[model samples]
Target: MTEPATRVIVVTVFVIGALTGCSRRDRGQREVIQNKGSDTLVNVAQAWAEKYKEVDPTVAVAVTGGGSGTGISALL
Candidate 1:
């Protein structure tokens, strides 16, 4: 094969490989699930967050414990 043909093939393969590895998921798009309340509930909230991350690696769940009032304020 000619040098130009070989170069074209190489470039094509590189482009295809790069695109195949690229994720269509928007990096900027994030799902935030906030859990707040008693410290006793913190463990359960963390567990849920971990499971969620397994399903949607991009999602971020923040768990804070300062009582229900604090949680509600944070939401606002």
Candidate 2:
């Protein structure tokens, strides 16, 4: 397959995996924002989460990073 096609497949798999994971979550009391992907973005995401928390204490933000594969598998 061509490179772009392969990338599209991978991204499609990732989005499907993410969506499936979302469906299984509980309807908890708190508002939650789940950000899981790319170890490289961990610090940046965390920083944003921290600031966001200060702005809105009622909402919850989760920032986790273990690598691209790890992030995707989290959706499983």
**Candidate achieving the largest TM-score:** 2
What are the Cα lDDT values of the candidates? Answer: 0.84, 0.90
Provide C-alpha RMSD values for all models, in order.
Answer: 13.3, 9.3
lDDT of 2 at 62: 95
Model 2 misplaced stretches (Cα beyond 4 Å)? 1-28
lDDT of 2 at 43: 98
* Model 1: per-residue Cα lDDT over 1-76, one tens digit each: 9999999999999999989958665778886777877677888888888998999887799888888788777768
Question: What is the overall TM-score of model 2 with all chains considered together?
Answer: 0.55
True-vs-predicted CA distance for residue 65, candidate 2, Å: 0.6
**Clashing residue pairs found in predicted model 1:** none
lDDT: worst 10-residue window of model 2: 21-30
Itemize residue pairs with steric clashes in candidate 2.
none
Quick one: RMSD of model 1?
Answer: 13.3
